[model samples]
Each structure stands twice: as C-alpha cells, then as structure tokens.
Target: MKALSTALTLAMLAGLAGCVGQSGSAASAWYDGRDAIPPRGDRIYICHAFGCALKTPVDFAGRDIAALRRILAEGRGSPAAERRAIAKAVQWQERRVGKIVGSDKDVGGLDMQNAGVPGQMDCIDEASNTTSLLLVAEARGLLRHHRVESPVARGFFLDGRYPHATAVVRETASGTAFAVDSWPEANGVEPHIKPLAAWFNDYPS
Candidate 1:
C-alpha cells in the first residue's frame, strides 16, 4: 500500500542485478504487498499469517522503549556483540508483541498446519517483521555498529527452492552484510544472525 510499485520496480531491478533481490525497498514492498504500515516512531505493525497477510499495530510506551535501550546498550562493545544484542532485542519484541498479535505460537518457517492463520509466520512475514524490529532499534539510535537494511530475498520457484526472504543489516565499519532471519526459529527465540553470503549459499533451514 505504501510504495508498492516502487518496491516491485526495485525487486525487478535486483533480479536483473543478480538473482531475485537483496536488501531494500524490495523487502519493504514485500510488506506493502500485504498493506503493512511501516514501522516508525514507537508504533510498529507486527506481521503474521504468512506474507504479512495480517498486520497488528502495537505501540510502545516509554517503559517499552527504555527496555529496548537497556537491552541494546549491552552491545556497544563491537559489531558482533551488537548483533547478539540485536537478536535479543528482536526476541524481546516478539515475546512482547506476541501477546497483542498472537504470534507467540508462531513456529519457524511455514506453519503448514496453520497456513494463512494468525499465530504463524512465513519467510515474508518473518523478514518483514524482523526488518521492522531492526528499524525500530536503529531509529532510536540504539544501534551504532550496524544499520537496518532492506529485506533480502533468495531463490525463485525455479531456483531449486521456493521463494524466501530475510531481514538484513550492514556493518558500518566494513560494510559486511548479515541476515537476521527468524523464520527458522519459533516465536521469541533468538534469530539466526549469519553472513548474507552464507545465508544465500545454504538452504533457509
């Protein structure tokens, strides 16, 4: 709904650049596909029900934001440490928001048993939600070593795999990219933070 055409156009260009897409509005467009309201300020749209087919708006109070700041403050040592804090923050957000959005029951990857139902999240949903969480942290100046980036997608239906996407971040010092993927973990579990290249090479398991 917000910049759908722009996202689609960027995705097309990313495919031409080299296989599907990588980081940026393409991921934002992924959310737009389901009419998600982008994360901004203290309000975020928690995406569930596969492909962000459903979005639940949750607002953070001052206490909630303070908790995030404290959680992230522990990672100021290095990029690697910050990544860990990021995973924790993402988990915290999931657990806290799950109560409101019901994603607490969400299993990693596709919850085939509950496809298109609330409490489940597919890659698209995971990627979009994770990206939103990262953006929230980044916007508040909690992240210093890395920056939230556009969501990245890999594998076409014909690329020996189904389409999949993940949230991404780039190291400010070295520009190294990493995949912040939570689709492989159950709700409230720490997400997998791996280099983007490695994530692309391996299956999204």
Candidate 2:
C-alpha cells in the first residue's frame, strides 16, 4: 500500500510538473542525498518553507547529507537510539511537509479534486504538495516506502488551493511533523523541510 501510494504521488507529481507525459522513464526516488540537503549536526533543526522562502530558527550550512545518513543509520542500530533517530527522522520529515498547507480550507471541494486527480492537464504546485506529504511520512518511518493519498482524502485542506492528507502510523515519542517538498528540478534533499508544531498538529493522537 505504501509503495503504491508513493508511486501514485510521484506520478501525480510528474503530471503536475509536465513530466508524466515525457518519454524517458527515469526512476527517481524522492531523496537521492544528492543536493539541497539540510545540516547534519548533533542537534538537528527542521525548518519550514513559506512564501518563496525557507523559514525557521535553524541554520542550514556546513551540513552534509552523508553525515546525516550515517547518523540515522547508526542511530537506528539500537533500541536506545530510537528516540534520537526518530527525532532526526521527524526533523527530516518536517523539512518537506511544512511547505504544504494542511488545513481544511487551503484545499476544499472542487479545487482539491481539480488539482489532485489526473486529467488532460494540471498544475505543478498541486502535485508537488501531494507528493511532499507522502515523502515525509516515508522518511519518518511511518511507511516502508513511498505512498500516495487515497482518491478520497478525508481530513484537512490547505488555505483553499490544495487538498492534503497524512500517512497514519503507530504512536511514537518522536511525535509527527509536517513535511514540505521542493521541486525535483531544484535537486537534492535541500528541497525538503518540516515544522515541529505543524508536523504533530497534522497527525493527531
């Protein structure tokens, strides 16, 4: 189910970006650890993307994705490391989820369907928003692979432009975060970020 969701979300994203109809079948995963990666310091911070700018108290420079990958991989090696690993994962997820609005009003009624479903044509922003959430859930370990929003997304819409849904997972101490995804053309993990508060708010107990 998760993998299917991820594929659908990506397909929607490709469609939105005008890549769905392209001839080249390049299989690109969400995070390639290529570029645009956040910092990997001991105390990691997740920033939110807002209105043509990346917003957050956290500073992201002198950080490397490889280091973060090592930390998360090593951290996941033990039960004692779960909290920290989860925290890092949540932070990572937030970086992507925050860019998208998850309120019921942001995307409701016809606007959401028009934006979400595939058709003769569509816009990139809508598909980008949809894929961002699923990728975050995948990064946070909520889902094994990537996933897509069901045709019927029951809860929450953004400020009347986009419809949003969340990936459900078992309760964890790390809490949930809202992830934001940057366009693929931008390159690397730098395109993602999430806010701590918004993340948990998006996923209720």
Candidate 3:
C-alpha cells in the first residue's frame, strides 16, 4: 500500500509538471507577440503578469510628470536620496499598476504557482515593466541624476543560481550603475535599488 501511494504521488507530480509546461509555452507565445516599443508621450504601456496594455492606468502621463518630479525633488541634493526617491516613485507606480490590473494580492517573491496567469507577474514581467517605467521617467525629464540603461541579468543555470533580471541605470555624474528590481516585493512596496556589483551578488530574500 505504501508503494502504491508513492506511485500515485509521482503521477500527480508528473501531471502538475505537464500543466506548468503548457502554461509556460502559452506565455512564451504571448511574449513573442509583444511590440518592442518603449513607453513614450502621454500614454505608456503597462506590463503585468499576463501581458502588456497601452493604457494610462497610473498617472504617468502629461501633468503627472510634475508629481513624479515632486517625488524626485526630495532627493535632488544627493545621489543616494535620488535613488531612494526613484525607488519610491517606482513603488507608487507599481501600486497603481496593481490596482489597474486588479492584481494587488500577488505573492511577494518568485511566485511560480499558476505561472501564466493574468496579474501574477514573474521576473520577466517585473523587469520589463520596471524598464518601461524608467524610460518613461527619463523621457519626461523627471530623472535628473541618472539615466536609464538596458536591463541587466544574472544567475543563469551556469551561474549556479536561478535566472533573474532587473532594470539598470547609470548615474550621470559618477557613472555608477544601479539595479532597480521590483520582483521581490509585494504590491505597493518599494523595490530594491543597489549598486550593480552588490545586486549581482544578491539572492532572493
């Protein structure tokens, strides 16, 4: 009877694996269909767990730039403070996205359960979304101290860590690089912003 139970458990596990694989395949197809355009002008494409939407959910358009500028103005005196402000602004926008998509209850970190479900973002979704937000901020002239850079990645299988990625930025004067990653936090929480070197060494908390 114990052996039979073990076999049943294995069957159930195999079934779950098949489901996950199918979900991942569908997600890949959806990702492939996305346009490579960056967010700009009065409208921005907000990406979430499922896919991208070209809607102004967050006040990231037009006069909202002033609000972003205000949030950023608080840290204008120092690079560290500016980065903190950027993180805070990003968190605020993330919360808005959460509400817009009705995905405010997503798990805090690395939620793989129901992997392709709408509103349940994975690292790819988070990184892409964060990069979009940075680009929009840069275009609006809201970022004074730093410039957006291409997204950086680490921890592929060869690195002995699970694959991960994050949005990156470079300070205009100091030329230091920083990673702005929001994947590990729950909705409405500030993202982790740290030096690129330290970010490379970080593991999910």
Candidate 4:
C-alpha cells in the first residue's frame, strides 16, 4: 500500500508541477483552494501542493496512538505541559511524514525550492498538518488542557510581513490562544509554541 501511494504521489506531482509552476503564491493558492481531508478512523492523510503524500495515509491505531498518548502524558494537566506535548507530537508527525514522503531533510523557513519540491512543505502545509494532528489528538481525548482551533493566519497585506499561517490551540482555563507554528523550524524539530499575540509580532528566525 505504501509503495502504491508513493507511485501515485509521483504521478500527481508530475502533473501538478506543470500547472502550479514554482511560484510560492501559486503553491499557496493551490493548497488553500483544496478542501481539508479529515482522518478516516485511525488514518490521516498528509498533503503537499505537489500532491498528497502517503497514499495509504498514516495509521494512528494502537501503538501510534499510544505513543501520542505517552507524549501527551508529559503535560497531563498543565497548559505548558500540553504545549510541550503538542510540540513533541508535531515533531513526531513531521518525522513520520518526512520519511514517508522522502523529504526527511527539508529545511525550515521560506525557501524558493519549497514551491517546487514534492516533499518540501510550505506554511500552508505545516499549518494544515498541525491542525490535523491536533484534531486527531482531540478526538482521542489526549488533550486535557488545550483544545484545537481553526488554523489562524496573519501577514501579507494584514501585517506588512510575508504571509504566514499556523495551527492554534486555546487553553481551556485561560482561553488564551497559542500558535503552534512548525514552518519556521526544520523537519522533526519542535515548533514555536507561543501566545498568538507574541507570534504575530515575531519575525522568522
């Protein structure tokens, strides 16, 4: 199944490349125009503008969910712990997805090649994937202190900075929203988890 998915991804990428070119705007639009594909039971699909990787999708059954739960366990009752768990879970997903898509060495931040590379992900990809992961965690009741929210975006005309987007989680007690931004970090690294206010003021580092 994994082999078949890989073949399909390669084929779709070949076709999409011609339509989207290497422009980041085109790539971003291509991603935004697509509907969010939800997880089917224990399986979740990871999307790239070039094509969706893991045709069979990643299965979150049994050990996978257990691993996630173990990560979440580290933060059990506190928002800070939940944030750490969120970061760890996201990094785990990044590593798994990167391996499946063969983009394990992808660098962080704005890279021109990301617009064209099959496995390299842009901010849209990161935000979408993170939201999906958070949603999955929520469904499994692994999150106690934080609840996943819709992906939030800022910048471009709104902030005079480059367009950026991230997944958000709201603390149940304080109702404070924190941005879980994975695009500015290298693959498999912990993402920037900060208050939405601070995240808005942040420049890429």
Ranking by TM-score: 1, 4, 3, 2
Stretches of candidate 1 off by over 4 Å are: 1-30
lDDT of 3 by residue, 143-191 (tens): 8888877665566443455556667778889988888888788777898
Each model's total of backbone clashes: 1, 32, 0, 0
Task: Give me candidate 2's TM-score against the actual structure.
Answer: 0.24
| TM-score per model over all chains | 0.85, 0.24, 0.75, 0.78
Candidates 3 and 4 compared: the better one by TM-score is: 4
Best first by lDDT, ranked: 1, 4, 3, 2
Cα lDDT tens digits, model 2, 1-205, are 9888667666544423422222111113211111112223322222223211221223323343443454456455443353344345434543433343221123221343433322211112322333433333344444422233211122222222232322222223333323332322121233323442353344321
Candidate with maximal TM-score: 1
- lDDT against the true structure, each candidate: 0.79, 0.31, 0.65, 0.70
Top candidate, metric lDDT: 1
The residue ranges of model 3 lying beyond 4 angstroms of the native Cα positions read 1-37, 50-63
> Residue 57 of candidate 3: its Cα lDDT?
42
For candidate 4, the per-residue lDDT at 27 reads 28
